[model samples]
Target: MFKSRRPGLVRRLWRSRVVTESDGHSGKLHRHEQRSMTHTDTAPGLTGEAGDLTEGAEREDEEQPDDDRGAMCVPEHRGSRRGQESDSRTVTCCLFGEWDFRPRSSYWAARKDGAGPCQCAPRRGVLEEDLASTAHAFLKRLKERSLDALVKAVETKGGIPGECVMVPNTELRLGAHHISPYYLLCKLFRWGDLPLSARLKPLCHCQSFGAVDSAKVCCNPHHYSRLCGPESPPPPYSLSRSDEHKPLDTGTSIGSVTSGGHRSHWCSVAYWEQRTRVGRLYPAYEPSLSIFYDLPQGTGLCLHGHHRHGGSSSSSVQQIRSKIGFGIVLSRELDGVWVYNRSQHPVFVHSPTLDPPSARGLNVKRVMPGFSLKVFDYECSSWMAEHSVKPESQEGPWDPHSVRISFAKGWGPCYSRQFITSCPCWLEVLLNNHR
Candidate 1:
């Protein structure tokens, strides 16, 4: 079974592709793997041990058509929650995964890490009021155009993503930028940091922006996807504020982990200022919040102190502090941990689920202000932590249990802020073995 499986057998992770249905829609359903991917368990395995995974050892990309899976081309139909279908009901296929015919390979293939399928739920209060200025504006735009109803219909639909919803072909402006209404909706609802290189293509056999007879433009979030390309690497994670670099105190219970036992607390939390520890480590129990930041009300892990950069410029400190307004609230939910970004600026996250690295690189999960993302997978993390190759270090190729959140800044090859330590205000969320 994917879940409850033994770890330590590191695999190749993900490869993208699709098989045509031999029956009817064979020609329409072409493969969309773009030398790209998210995760996959059905991917082939390594010939040797994990360490032997080198460039030459990698295999060539090829499409394998599975008739059994393709036979599921018949989409089970039902009435959507918010509204009625446009013209034709959206097609949901087991092969086409979730987000509007997006291949399952584009999802987090947790089975690759000895975990279950991708059920990563969206963060709560995504469209509610109390968002940052930019986010509020986006929400207002959606509601104004009555596009929010369409998005909800797509999201809450029973089968595949609901049918396409469209808007005027003209550009929608937010602040100084002119943006595609559909692309922006996808960014808000589906992919948090939808890549700049990605362009919206209508679902296979669907019409273009205006080609649809009645629907001017297709606005369905899942109806479009980014062209296949290599994802950019995220910034490196740093632990300390001092010139002397120190590894993050990942709050590992070495004895419990090695002995295959459990920790006393649900998680151990720490607030960081550059490299300096803000205060004592906080232990979180059930029913209580795991970690929180600079909130207007009840506080837990608050961001304070200017150990380095912010200390120099009071105005800069205030500017950053303003961005940190309303901070974030992270809590342990059903089987995973969810983070709601209540701050004005975007929050960048890197956790086991977000960054499963094989040394090639990783994409740091970005949660825009007002939205949320499942930052940690508890079952997967606990299992990996107990069975990890290196139990002591939390900053391994991928630390399954701990999570890093950067406030307003993101670390990566793409951004100037390339390390977590360089980020002015950030938090280190280290989970305990509480499975």
Candidate 2:
């Protein structure tokens, strides 16, 4: 009985173990099959579907005649290329067309800076006015011709016996000419006006005359006293003067002051005359209002000196600052100051009067090495102190009557060492009190 029971139990245990192992193997195979199916389904969702659609379309296209395919593709390719070219052309026009919208003054400024040719369109208002004037003149001439012809015809036909000769009327219509709108637009927008260079020629000639005359009279010592006479020697060129007043005509030889006793301020251009190692003077000329004097580098001192070392010690270390180039525009009504950076490094300008406090302080303007800036409507005296010091004051009274030009940074003065012992430069605007 024990032997039979032992054999049966051993058979059952072996069968159960074999069944469990088979079940585990089957479960792993099922999971792997599911993962493979999921990967295959998701991977082909969008890209594979699109590729299949494209292939089907391509097969259909291949079935069609080659000539038909070429004909269809040629136009599509040409259209795309033309569209790209048109977009490029539009971008170019947009870039250049902006100049046309700028003010006339801006155009002149850009020209002065030696910018590229301006693609600005003509002034619409001026074009319309010109066209209207031309049309009116033409119509007037036509009317006169028609009247003359009518009279001649009547005279040939024997003048009307008693009353009047009635001539046949002819209708005049501009539309009959069949003028193109494009042609008209082109005519109206064409830049046909004189250039800035051409307009400046006359003014430049006048200024040149003044500058030459002043140079001859001031530069030659023999001619100076003779031309100026014994009563008063030609006054030294100064940034500002108050002691002596000379008429503009006598002082500058450019323009005469108003006879009505109204005070008029004039802009002066002067060259620095080095008399000795420590002595220098300015000889001025009244430049034309329409022209600008380009102050070259290493030519004249542009700033006044602020003594770092006191007394005689300051003279030993006195140095002229870096070379600078700038321009000055002066007029009774309009004035401007412009700076052109001609150096390898940046420059800074500080004007207590012209610039706002925010800009005058540590936030001074940084003029890049090759850039320029135009400040309009500048007045030299506008920056002067409001209060005046009494001449009797023991302390060195502040000279409220001075033009100060200061530069914050640059090479210490070397070229102008013979003339100036300071860093900055100043000019005095002399008020002409002579009648």
Candidate 3:
């Protein structure tokens, strides 16, 4: 729980690892038992794994198909909310905004029942003339196949959870590049589009079809969780309304977020040198957001001081600091934590939310300049932890809640060096147990 605190106490906590924010009172620091980064001795360990820097470490990759009329239900009424009743047939397909976020593009127009939460904010409609006819046709075809999958299941005396309906992996073309069939289908039916290879899990009945780089896969929109994220959008997220408001622009408050009159922190941002902690812990709480940058700031995490590259002897302290540039801004929202790469260079990120459900693989994303990503999806994170895996390899480190990000350069087997300790500058985003 968090409450408005004496400014002095707030300042002290920011300047040091006060660890536990008070419930308008005081408490002790805790090393929460969450997943940790690899090379624990050399990496910035999480709560319970805390250790002073004796050394260094840190660091950190979808489809569809088609069918018939009895294959799907005919719409009687449209645009209703869940729990509220209507005369139309029940929607046997995915519905955007049902997955922890607001919808993107359009919603289920032919559905008989209402949709889910935080009803989407009014969005400006796209002009038909502006979009290619092929794009519209592709989307329409997708909807037909989505419901057709359900109809097949019902016909066989099975249900939405019965089987994976086959689909072309690259069925739709938008602009110059092709898009993942399931991704676009999910965007229209599941929810908003995401940047990271947001993994989609097939229902138990469709699990056999879940895999990477498959030429053919399931197209049942309801087969995948409505919470589907992107799977490397080489075509770009141009299809989603590009002008929509950004996560950083939200007016969420920072350290003063509260729950039951006590303070609650979503996560703590820590800058590091090899394994040594640099600066104070920047706790991003709910209702507000904060930034981690190299420049002076009235508030948020300002990464100052010099850092020496333990592994790379050629780079100097000034060079490492320069790499920070404007750094990134990490925000805590009711849905999850977001990171905006405000710096000039790309930042490599690894988080539990980035774990692909189908393969159980941990992906390190390369977030480029001026780009932002929902680094952690709270709902997804919780779901992953339930079926958590302890990856014991250099390519992966298991943590359903914690996140690690390396700046400027990258680490791991593909890079010149391995481990976050070799990274000149990096960050450890340790999520709070309470969140």
**Cα RMSDs, all models:** 23.2, 39.1, 25.6
Which window of ten consecutive residues has the lowest lDDT sum in model 2? 220-229
Clashes of each: 6, 12, 27
Error of 3 at 177 (Å): 19
Query: Local error of candidate 3 at 323, Å?
Result: 1.9
lDDT of 1 by residue, 235-282 (tens): 221212231111111221222223456446667777665666666677
lDDT of 2 at 269: 30
Q: Please give each candidate's TM-score.
A: 0.37, 0.24, 0.41
Off by over 4 Å in 3: 1-260, 286-293, 296-298, 306-317, 358-362, 391-398, 433-435
Error of 2 at 175 (Å): 33
Highest TM-score model number? 3
For model 2, the stretches where C-alpha displacement exceeds 4 angstroms are: 1-279, 288-333, 336-348, 357-401, 406-435
Q: Write the per-residue lDDT of candidate 2 for residues 1-435, one digit (tens) a residue.
A: 444343333222222221111124231211111011111121111211111212223223223232112111111111122434343321101111222333554322222222233222233223334444443333233333333432332222211111211111222222212221111211222211211111010011122212321221111000110011012221232212321111112222233356896435443333221211222333233332211123322233343332223333232222212232232222221233333333333333333333433331221233432233332223434433333212221124333232222222211111222222133322223222121
How well does candidate 2 score on lDDT at residue 330? 23
The residue-by-residue lDDT of candidate 3 on 54-98, one tens digit each, is 112212100001111121111222233334333332322221222
Best-performing candidate as measured by lDDT: 3
| Superposition TM-score, candidate 3 onto the true structure | 0.41
Tell me the lDDT of model 3 at 69.
15
Candidate 3 lDDT: 0.44
Q: How close to the true structure is residue 309 of candidate 2, measured as C-alpha lDDT?
A: 32
